[model samples]
Target: MKTNRGGGDEALKFSSFFFMPERPRDYLVLFIRFSVIACLVVSVSLVLRATFLSSSPRDYSTTYGLRFTTVPQKSIALSPTGSIGPLNVSHILFCIAGAAETWIDRSQYTSLWWRNSTTRGFVWLDKPVNLPQNHSDVRFSIPIRVSDPGWTRFKFSSSRAAVRIARIIWDSYRLNLPDVRWFVMGDDDTVFFTENLVKVLSKYDHEQMWYIGGNSESVEQDVMHAYDMAFGGGGFAISHPLAARLANAMDGCLQRYFYFYGSDQRIAACVSEIGVPFTEERGFHQLDIKGDPYVYLSAHPLTPLVSLHHLVYLDPMFPNKNPIESLQNLMKPYSLDQNRILQQINCHEGKRQWSISISWGYSIQIYSYFLTAKELTTPLQTFKTWRSSSDGPFVFNTRSLPPDPCQRPVTYFMDGAEDVRFYGTKTRYSVADKNFGLCENNTEHSELTKVKRILVTSMKMDPEYWNKAPRRQCCEVMEGGRGKRKENEMLIRIRKCKSSERI
Candidate 1:
């Protein structure tokens, strides 16, 4: 064995290279040192694994595949599909600003949109009212909750109600209703298109601070109440986090802004202190104007129509109908296609030199002569400023009616809309008023004059369309794909524009 120990001798030499401890206890010492090293390695591995997990953010995606990153505790905006889900009407808590005196008249307006079970929140009245025992009989969809009497203590130069109204935000936040994401405040007369509102809000993260609303249509009003202020009548939305922060600072904020003229102004001032800026959404119409809203509505912005306020001060939405009745008619088509309601589309037939503009679910304008896409989209100045009744500055561009009525487009108001099942929908528009004069019996005008009704066919717009950048839909006159005359009727189809197509 000693004679043939070639590899064995090398192994022994390698083992003895570290001066061998001669005691048996030395082996135990060596084993303890290796064990300690093993334990430290295992401990380090576990610490690393935990640190990676704790520092890494959880990812959340929306129905549209929008991704948001958040940490463990403050992952507020993440959909609870596993924890929360996409924003729905139930997540929105509407805090309606109302008064006991106006409740009788304004309750009618609230009943129009408010759903008893489907919608959440209450009509916060200045004082408790003698509400009917059987709420269903009265057709009121929202229950009344009297605002805390504590609002009267705030100092204010404006109507004392402004102070109370401003507190609606704090009041709604303090309720601590579970699962609420947004607090929407509006006047009793404000009509909200809740479906479209949900669509708009779905784009924003509810956990983050958002002060969303619209400025007054009248420059005078905006100048008086900071152009950025979200007029309460037009309605505004505050995200859950922002509302909570607002609640904490609100009482002191109210005292500071007591001299403000409007409840909305006071709110804007407080929100400014929190370092949140006003986010103006075109869809929320303060409607700070007097007279017919027809012109303004006819040329709505290329966005979802969210809310309308001051209906009591203006003429009804349609001719030959009162305000409520007109609203009832409008809601008919709105129920059918909410996103398409008041959406404007223009098409021209070259053969007849005819230009047609369609306000889906609202009105139609037809002209024998040609008008550029830009001109047709601009609303006519048929309305005056809210305060002065002057016909000057508006937030958007407006074209004055021609002194000659002949230059104006023949207008048609929506009559009805019907769903076409598997296909789409058909909206009918008929002449409402014969107020505008026709051009002196020209042959081109003759052909247009004979047409009495317009039938619009369109697919129900997906609510997700609002989540992206807005583009006006393109339209084509049916039959010849140009304006073809029918016996007192015209048919048109609306659809998304081709990639290479122009409006």
Candidate 2:
């Protein structure tokens, strides 16, 4: 089922502000985390955006020369009642790729949103599926075909992509009909944010000859042969004109590069030869970045976050993908605000001052702050009362009163007064310096208590409100209880509390 791992052309050479390793697969995790901060041959000023807000139509026309007659917008909002807002999401046609074995894992998460007809769908498989009599809708299924009977047979490695993937390009292109303006293609495990996908596509004209794709292996994949071949796994869009042209030219192109092994790179070759360049959108992630994508997807930057690739190896998208409880009940009212999430969104390292990364998975670290975090271990019998100190009794509560586990912000309670100053260009940025999230004292409640509460936010609670949140209270336990603390790894083992009341 994991066959057709794609490949890229004569590796796109570069001499700019960015550097991608020749063997990216080996170091994808390190590359994704550090690349954003370290490898910038020419770091283009990142256009910081707030979540849920739409940006003005971006003009990629001059660079890629891919614009056409008209470009619509993709920012739609849901009204107060949770119904459809101004934007109609059905404009997208989702083309999902997977073998018979992986189809369930890939399509089930997205199935939550696929019932809507305006947003049509198709599952591209190696062979036709036999649907149950009770489930007789053929609208979401497409069996790929190749004149060569053996074209679809390939291993789950990148070496065979060039030859096997031509069938996908053609099969996907065949679905580029007039009814839908955009055609999006992705592997089985890809999740499409219909709302964001629409928002992104609306920026470009559907009639134009455009290949709305993402990075192959570097920043600004727009360089020469790199021309932004859609990373097929993260999901890519094709305007009708561009898709039609690709489908029309696919046969001859396939014959020309018959021995090529990477499907995506080969497609890029065809598109490059035909003159439709790929325009990258940051939101479409194409790699198995950090293991837990909860934070990445939950509070992504202001850009319309579109897709997350390689979910087969991580925890469920949400432990409770669909929580029975309402989000309003579990989350703060402000969780609905799009601007705050985008505005406070940041990533940094605590090299100089000390920073703490709230992590859920190998790479899915959430909040990165200048504050240093220390584990405060105390014996239940030996400890008497809680008092404020440079040290903290921050409680990691898998029990009561905490929002979502992912929502927990790494915090440090200073002795007398802690003034936060965000500097150091690479690892930190202050609120005054154009960034999202608030790094200030917790004054919302009666903070003048036994212990003071300072809130460090990543704007993650809102999305997790509806699902199961980690009720584990650490900082909140100390702040909510009595506290004493210190810095960095002290590594003193304290026995786990057998009962809540050991005082």
Candidate 3:
């Protein structure tokens, strides 16, 4: 009985050690499942937290507003008769008041508003506290100095003018202003289209963009070429950091260039010297208020945005109806190609020459020529031929022989204008500054010979339809002339040449 009991006990021990009823296994599986579920819950919580943080707006806010000022240099008579006194002061006051009213009215509906306008009492004047002097944060004040009757005569030299403007802007900064992002300085003559401007500013990354303006000058080029950096004083913005830099640089700049002439130029020079990154937006202009279809602004188109300048020409009733409007209206119903041609040609009554000058990239020269109107019209055919021809050394003839490739057709209203001098030359031939004797030649003659060949080839073609013929005729004539014609005949043939060849 004792042996049997002992064996039973051993058997019981072995069963307990090797195969307990799967309860432990169940417990172990449960633990693993619970652990996995806990991990998933934690992971989900973390993901939610991260997403919330990533999507939340920053704690600070950006303040934006328009700042306007005016500088009148001289007075001029408004009417043809000199009986009336100079209207300069009245004109400036009118502009200042208009700008003020417009901004005040617009601000009621928009978040951005002007601090001071003629309609609204000057509230910016109340603030006189100083703030940090750091590069990213600055503060100063501007005293209203235009209280005199002839304030129009108060010409603050460019340097003083810059300082005065800078002081006012610096002083206007709200003390410890949180996240003050940008300050836009504009002339009193400017009218801000806040909605459009805000929409544009929202699209750009403010951190990367600095010194935003209607125009900008390349620092290197402006300094090297002594060209003005395009700071359209009419409308410009500076980021907080740039403003700090400007404040610091102002004194040194004034000392260096004591007699600066152009306000925009001086600002650009200072910014360039300080190595600030600058950007320009298109819709800004300095001189004209006419809105161009292809441009955002009339005179200086910034990047892709459009802004107008010289608000004096802006019609209150028809804001966009100046020259640009007229052109746009005339071409509005036309096809794209027709519109393009019109734009290229300035098809308006007083703007024919305007069109050709822009197309030829000779605006100044064309303007000068246009002033000589009768002489200009006399060369209409010559200009037309020049416009039509692709290659040069244009030729003309007084007495016609074979049709001249260089000969341009002329239309004259005046009678007895036979033997119109059509100018043509082989474009390849460089005009030698040295006087050409009857048979002068030099060691560099080979270059001239090559050019002459190219010119001859360009102008070779049948005379009957010189302007309408294929370009290959020119090549044929140059390569396969029948024989040497008389000098006079060659000259006459050149004179009768027309411009029909395709490029």
Ranking by lDDT: 1, 2, 3
Model 2 Cα lDDT, one tens digit per residue, 25-123: 746755575666654533433323432234666545444433333212321111111112233465556666666555544455455445554556566
Rate residue 44 of model 2 by lDDT: 38
What is the lDDT of every predicted structure here? 0.84, 0.42, 0.32
Candidate 3 residue 101 C-alpha distance from true site, Å: 16
lDDT of 3 by residue, 393-480 (tens): 2221111111431221110000001112243222211112111122224322222222211121112222222124212111111222
Off by over 4 Å in 2: 1-88, 131-165, 172-176, 216-227, 290-301, 315-503
RMSD of each: 8.5, 28.5, 21.4
Model 1 global lDDT (CA atoms, 0 to 1): 0.84
List candidate 1 stretches off by more than 4 Å. Answer: 1-83, 132-134, 480-485
> On a 0 to 1 TM-score scale, where does candidate 1 land against the true structure?
0.82
Model 1 clash number: 5
Candidate 2 TM-score over all chains jointly? 0.46
